[model samples]
Target: MEAWLLLLACLLIPFVVLLIAQRGAGKTKNGSRIPPGPLALPVLGSLLWLRHSSADLEPLLTRLFARHGPVVSLRAGSRLSIYVADRRVAHAALVERGAALADRPPATRALLGESDNTISRANYGPAWRLLRRNLVSETLHPSRVRLFAPARSWVRGVLADKLLRESEQAPPRGVMVVEAFRYAMFCLLVLMCFGERLDEAAVRAIGAAQRDWLMYVARKTSVFLFWPAVTKHLFRGRLKTGFALRRRQKELFLPLIEARRARKDRISRGAGAAAALKADTTFEHSYVDTLLDIKLPDEGGRALTDDEMANLCSEFLTAGTDTTTTALQWIMAELVKNPRIQENLYNEIKATTSGPEEVTEEEVNKMPYLKAVVLEGLRKHPPGHFVLAHKAAEDIEISGYLFPKGATVNFMIADMGRDEREWQKPTEFVPERFLPGGDGEGVDVTGSREIRMMPFGVGRRICAGLGIAMLHLEYFVAVLVKEFEWKEVPGDEVDLAEKTEFTIVMAKPLRARLVPRSRN
Candidate 1:
């Protein structure tokens, strides 16, 4: 019966898709100035030709950007979707008039499940403000981040060891270090989140659970995100898969969260922490501890649920790990592809420290070229080509386009960074461009005043993890570069081809040879 139903659905796929597409929906119903985009047929707006997945839509969107101006308007299902590729307009909207564009779409709730404490998906208001504040102020604060030094230092060694093992185990062709980079990042973030340093098996278990669920959220369940009233009823299969993934996530994360809660409870009394983390020299508090104490203002001053805690903690782990690891691989690939840049960066590192004893996070601050390299990597390829959809809180106008209230809007992050107007040789990996007197010099990453390149986004809803992310990229990239000479394999070359998943990543998964570099 299920197979027959699926087969019937498959046969009706084309008709169903056509019906879901609203061709005339993109028309200016109010007769106001609207952004120009591809013309559409009724029942299938411009979306008739596009797929909901990022990978499938990337090329189409690129073509759309080239056709329409920086701002393009299209209708997806029943909602008017606007894409912003212009940095100046993005600045005007997200920075100058941010309050109106701060809310996320309602469909983001699909990922949160029953949890509402997630900062990334929460609506723009007190609940969001409180959760984001708890993260930025208590957990990710500069002082609090500094306390994770032990975790970072530990991961540095683990990363080096893993890289050595992988390189040695590589086939004659080469080996892919993607898993190593990802695993190291997970270890660091897991320790930071749970206040526990897990082993390879345990770490991979948590990471598997996370990646499985995120994959579903990013692709499989996105159908529910567009016109959920209809998709919810029609897409029971996707929802069922999401629920199963959610269950597995809870099964894996609950014990961890519960353990921490128990420890916190014990500490609340005079019992103190169960001496489990006694050997840890640093980090008296964990991110989960911060989440446990949070009392949402909008929720009648009640504590967060386990589901909510899992979401927040998982958000921290995945957001920090995946993005940073992608960055590390990209930076390393760039260094391998361009040995001149790698050597120059190495010399910069040598100049910063007395000798080649691992690069400390503090030393990371003084390395301008290193900073520039990391910045350039982010510019060349931001994690997401586009940020999370930002809903307009009110009808706002920008760049000669009418933005309807409650419409979905997002910026083209990759395009803005690569805009020929703002960046010269936008796709090249030249860190010097960010140095003084260079075209990319003194580039404002925050996008506070100017709308240059904002990888972490800008305005009130800017990434709360921006500060710590920067530190991770700079610190780990420094350590990786300082320790080994990343070389492109003879038979296996580094392919810069990009594949979009949760983040736009190197399609080939960054295979390379690591030769230990001498401090000389």
Candidate 2:
């Protein structure tokens, strides 16, 4: 009996040793290593390791990268969350193996109502291709973007009047520029969407309704991330609020969308010439009209329902406004803090423009320094720190590491732009880096083959609105700089501390004295 027991123990000991070794290395049953990360606690997984909500993850992600190197994994319950902070690796995997990293996380898509619609959240398939192509080709194509030139020019005058009214008060207090930025962007997008320049009250109502929905999305809707089957009981109230917010958006947007549809219908019924004369709004083309016309080949050849149309319009408005506001705030703040850079930019604008008579949209292209400043602002403070999470379509290998299928992938946009290895004085704000003979002179924002800095993400999922976004930023910043000196308030210093909302915004809203240089 003793001899048999001893032989059994010796055999079992080696197998136990192998199991222990693999577990120590964090290897899966298939002997694949998920990237190095903090050990997960049972049930909670790595939730305890996180210091804040997922939206505001810059600080938490920064620490994780430092501890575990560029590629790290965090287990969110049963889901594996993988983060890639290194830009070189990001380009190699996301750009080269775009298909593998193209699909979105299942949970995120379902939660965002993008499961089968919306270009940003649609899965990788025929529907996605159709929606993306429509968005890029029909809605925001280069030619269509030029059609909004009148709207953009109008917004500049509105913004200037706002800054003047806010600053011309007693003693020139800090004029909170956040609202102005948001309003201007909302006006521009609303006009592009409905082909109408609405009054201030109507625009504000639309902005407010959209903001309510965005607030629920960014703040109150955490339970959606969990498996709904399990959290349904707990999250019922929040989900109801989410629905109510959706109804509010439909209430506001349905009217605008319906008006567009009515006009389109009249034209389709052979009243085309007469309808054009009677129409209250005239857009060379409206995005809503484009949405109304889409026939989804994947969804049994159905046109978008009124609800879906509302959601898309909401998405169009929210996507354009919040981000532009954030970028404008940052650019204006930097200009306020660094007057010397502003002066140089102003001088460049003056040199480029023919005496600065409101600086027409066509002339904006000639101002390189203004473009450089906008690009630098985007690089330093990208609207989104991480691209919307990408999911691996299959078990993929990159640089000797395994990224398993069904895993969520994210890249650190802020970290990539600020990588000390790639940028000189990475923390400082300098627009010249993107100018001629400068550090980032020819750096490509698009990661076609290589990614230097992606303020708008790269890969097939790169922002469809990239061209319009750049034009909007460049045009607005140039108009503002030409109109105002944008000086820091008396005894109040400029603060660039970041706070995450829908986008990364200044913790203290940008407030400065707007000294008019030229009247629009």
Candidate 3:
């Protein structure tokens, strides 16, 4: 069945919207570290109180800090959850005790697949360490990322073309191109993963199917996280549907995997036909190459299972696409609402691109204003409200607080972004704050210096795609501004309110009117 076919089965997919646990859902444990929170329920835990919005989680986390304290613990039935809002606490756990706290929470096992210790979902283990090392050295290395330039450019062209088509006969209010952003991101990631470019229609079909599968998995899997047996029996239909969705993913991906393997074989034979393969700009480079090339330690000196490769491939595309696209939407909305800042940024781009060749990688690295704009946006609206949950690998103490070994620890990415002590006028959208000589300026976002804001996370499990994400953001933002002048449609003010899924995104899709600037 088509992935979209399952869209009508939300009734069966009750797990999608309901399993999310609220930040302050339950009562606090009487002893041990952290502060206080709401009361918990049996089995369902504090998740019963969570609303539909993940974007709302961050603001709620901020509010909870005010009401309770910086560090608060909540009881979700038998599970004890702690929310660390203070920078010091965050630094203590994520940085100071980095290795000891690098394990992913055990709750992630269901979707993380069997054993759950791989990149992203994997816990701290020999396998995870090997996976992370292999990924950094092989697939996501700076050199490998450089090979993706053509992919980025292709998607950007598609994005610009789509915007142009939408604006051709504008009826006044800026066209709402929110879905365009998602599609572009999906296309880029798809090409990156499959290493082969598809026609626009194929790209759209793949993107739509992927989105459907993701939405379903994200929503339904929450149930399995907290209450295993009861949810399994109660939501049997959802479970079946989930299985069907996974099968659908296999249908879409398995073929691509097979084709890539065939292509690799052809090239290995020194076939002249393989030489006819189109330019780097045309044919997509499969991420599978990296996976196929790297030998995992798990196969007992043999190759990894198809399932493991699938998980890694899916994760590479899904993680980067959703979060980056969501961040793109938020950043564009910020530009639309703040035109002066947009113009200033445009001027910076104009200066860099005043000559002939398109903005080079080196040139992009030099744009302080553009860098600040992205940093500010990331700080204001982090992709994930909190980094993926980190577990205490060993009992550790920091700043008089003790986090027991194996405790699931979460840091507030949004709270740190808006921390009043770290950022001056934290609520305002002041890109200048990140500029030289400004408050919070000169702060390193690389997480090497304490944890103030971590959108991609910190320490051992920090996003492997961090470099690629930054390149895409800066490149697209620069090209986007150069291509058209963005404005806020009068009736529709850009709403900064956030919504949640895997990533914290704008509740309402961004709708903006694009007027092309004189290219001359």
Predicted structure 1: lDDT: 0.81
lDDT of 2 by residue, 1-520 (tens): 9999999999778766754563475445666687877766444556554655665556777888898889988776667789999888898778888899999876432543533477777778988898788888887998888778778878888988987888787245768888988998999898898777789998999999988877777787655565556675577777677778888888988998888888787888898745554354467578898898899887799998898888788888977998888888898899999999999998988888887478887888888888889989998888888898899999877765678899899999999998889889988889989888888998888889588898888898888888889988999898888888888888778888888777788999888888788543
Better of 2 and 3 by lDDT: 2
Instruction: Please identify model 2 stretches exceeding 4 Å from their true place.
Output: 1-32, 41-43, 47-56, 107-115, 277-280
1-520 per-residue lDDT for model 1 (tens digits) = 9999999999788765654454333335556565777765444456444644543666777788787767877766556788888888999989888999999877644543565558888889999988888889987899998888878899999989888777667746566888988899999888888888777898998899888877877777656555677777787777777788777877878898888888877777768664534565324678988888888777689999888888787889888998888888888888989999999998899899878588888799999999999999999978888888899998887766778788899888888888888788887888999899888888888898687788988898888999899999999888988888888889788888998777888998887878777622
Query: In model 1, which range of ten residues has the least summed lDDT?
Result: 19-28
CA lDDT of 225 in candidate 3? 54
What TM-score does each of the candidates earn? 0.91, 0.92, 0.87
